[model samples]
Target: MLTEVKERLHSLGISVSSEPSNVDEVIIKFSIEKVTNHIKNQTNLSEIPTGLKEIAIDMVVGEYLFSKKSMGLLNIDSLDFGLIEKQVQDGDTNVTFAVEASSTPEAQFNAFIQYLRHDEVDFIRYRVLIW
Candidate 1:
C-alpha cells in the first residue's frame, strides 16, 4: 500500500522523505502551480481552475489526514495542523507538513506518513481533473 502511494506520488511529481529517528519526521512538499500547469498542459481548457486556486488549504489537508487515519494507514493520534507550513517559491505554492503523534512503530509510522503525505496532495489533481 505504501509502495503504491509512493508510485502514484512520483507519477504526479510530489516528493516524500524523512529522517530516521525515534520519532521519525516525514516531509511532504509539492508545487501548487506545477500542478495547475500540469493540468493546463494535459487538458484543453483555457480557463484557470478557480476551484484549485481557491481551495481551502486547511480543509483539504485536515480532511486528507483524517481520511488516511480512517483507512488504517496509521495510528496518528493527532495532526499538528496548526503547525503546517506553506511557502511560495519561483511562482509555485509549496505546502509542507511534519508527522507527529503517531502510535505506529517508527518505520511503519514513517511509511504511513509518507503514504498520506504524498497521496493526499496528489489527490488534488484528481479533484481538479474531474471538476
Candidate 2:
C-alpha cells in the first residue's frame, strides 16, 4: 500500500517519506507547504473522484496520518462500495467512524490519497460538516 501511495505521488510529481507506526497510521514527512502550493497552482478539487471526500477528510482530521482501519471500512470491494457505518453522539452530528483491518487495504489506501494533492477544501469541508 505504501508502495502504491509512493507511486501515485511520484506520478503526480509529489514527494514524501512515509513511515508506518502500528497498523493504523502512516506518518508522511515532506514540506506540506510545497504540496499545498502545488495543489493551489495545479489541481482542482472537482477533479477528485466522487467517493474520496470522507477518506480525504479523515486524512486531514488525522493530520496527514492515514488511518488504515477507517480506510478499510470505507473502500469498495469487488466493485462494491461495501459496508461501513458512522456513529454520531447525541446532540452532535459529528460521527466517529471505526473499523478493523479488512481485505481491501490497497483500494482504501488508493482512495485516501486520490485527492491528497488537490486542495485544502477536503479538510475544510469536513470541519464545517462536523461542526
Per residue, candidate 2 scores C-alpha lDDT tens digits across 6-52 of 55445534444443653223443332333333333333443334445
Estimate, for each residue in 42-84, the C-alpha lDDT of model 1 and write its tens digit.
4434544555433323222333344445557644444323333
What lDDT score goes with residue 90 in model 1? Answer: 54
Q: Point out the worst 10-residue segment of candidate 1 by lDDT.
A: 22-31
How much lDDT does candidate 2 score? 0.41
Residue 99 Cα positional deviation in candidate 2, in Å, after optimal superposition: 19
